[model samples]
Target: MKEYASILSKDGLKIATFSNHFRSEKGVMIITHGMGEHSMRYKEMADFYTNEGYTVISFDIRGHGLSEGKRGHTPGYEFLMDDIERVYAQVRADYPSLPIFLFGHSMGGNLVLNFLLRKPNNIRGAIVTGAYLKLGFEPPKWKIILAKLSSSIWPTLSQPTELELDALSRNKEVIRKYENDELVHDRITSAFFVNVHFAGQYAIDHANEIKSPLLVMHGMEDRLTSPTGSQDFASNSGDNVHLKMWNGLYHELHNEPEKQEIFNYEIEWMNKLLN
Candidate 1:
């Protein structure tokens, strides 16, 4: 079953959500999407999980998709965490008795890791892909200085992300679709950019504090976010955390040609954890 709804955020913003339910679900997967994208983008992955007897829940973060907030802008990092907490609480209340796992990609991956470290939760495990721990390339020194300066005064000032579209996936069709999608944006605010950049490092520095099992995956050839970040994170994290580097794939592993194999691996890992 597929359902759509909206939930009010803590400060009274409407957050759009989507869910795919299975009759006898074995578990629940809560997905958080990356910057400039919405929850609906994960339809294929959600369907795969539902077929595997798991219900899936995903929400557009406050600033993206059908949710309310300035596009690509948020007041601060705490608001982002509160949005995740709201969705998580709803899932826990609705599904009271199923194993819950969190999955995040790109910026969403960064947020999930930070959330796990800073917030108290009972999730069974988390899966992170292409987390923006470090950018594949550094920004111009002047641009960095400008962003820092503006972040304090006009934090919500939006700027184009200027990402290379081709770096997202090896599948040409995926890039084509992403390029054409109206909901897919390229805006990022100074505050959003600076805060997440630092938050990524914070998650890495405190990786050892994470108590739940973590599966950190990144594409070795990813030009969007550095795989070394994933490498460093898994190494610093506890033994329960594991890392997988996909060779030749770009940033979006779930959208790559070998996505099925990747999905199977994730399901297998989750099953092992559940057992």
Candidate 2:
């Protein structure tokens, strides 16, 4: 496995990207990570894809990981999609002849879906895991109204402090590493949450317009985004969609113990599509 780093200039921001290539002669898989996390967490998956004769590329989206910007905040909902498009352009320029696949997880999944709705022809196919089509927390109607108001006045207002320990209790090692990692942002802003909620609804409203072949995956035991989001996406994405739900996996299927099985399934699916 080999790793490389590059910087992408998007919307006047220097975004950092980390990539792993297994075989120099194979297709490319571009990964987009979810909220609060960076691209480095995907090293294992990148290596796995590389070993399977694929070049894997992932970038730290603005406000996450080693990328430039405030942690957990976006200028607007569409800014993240712009970042994805810029990164895709960079990867495509380098490997113009290779088949390209987009893989996104969590908030990354939401971004991929939104991208597809707007630019369906950009990639060969896409895979979304633990996507947030609908959120678990159903804020009151008034709170939603207030959040929007607050965003304009105080876009950077800190949100409910996220407890990584509470969220990752099942994986003590991950929690330990996250707590010690300075790059990971544990706190979100009010505007970030507001934008995410809007994005979630927007994707749901336009899911059927997606034209790319899609593979959607979720863990049955996932408590974060809920498997319902994947279910909704798969059901509405028309005939070009495939759905897989792991019996005991959590939100991060790639980090689960059965990740190898899931990874193999995704690779096989993509291989079949490319062929």
**Model 1 clashes, total count:** 0
Each prediction's TM-score against the native? 0.97, 0.92
Could you give me the TM-score of model 2 versus the true structure? 0.92
lDDT of 1 by residue, 49-78 (tens): 988889899999988988998999988899
For residue 14, give model 2's deviation from the true position in Å. Answer: 1.1
Clashes of each: 0, 0
Runs of candidate 1 with Cα error greater than 4 angstroms are: 140-142
User: In angstroms, what RMSD does candidate 1 have relative to the true structure?
Assistant: 1.2
lDDT of 2 by residue, 121-161 (tens): 56888999988776555669998899899999999887754
Q: Which ten residues in a row have the lowest lDDT in candidate 2?
A: 161-170
Q: Where's the lowest-lDDT run of ten residues in candidate 1? A: 17-26
Cα deviation in Å at residue 127, candidate 1?
0.3
RMSD of each: 1.2, 2.0
Query: Which pairs in model 1 have colliding backbones?
Result: none
Predict model 1's lDDT versus the native. 0.91
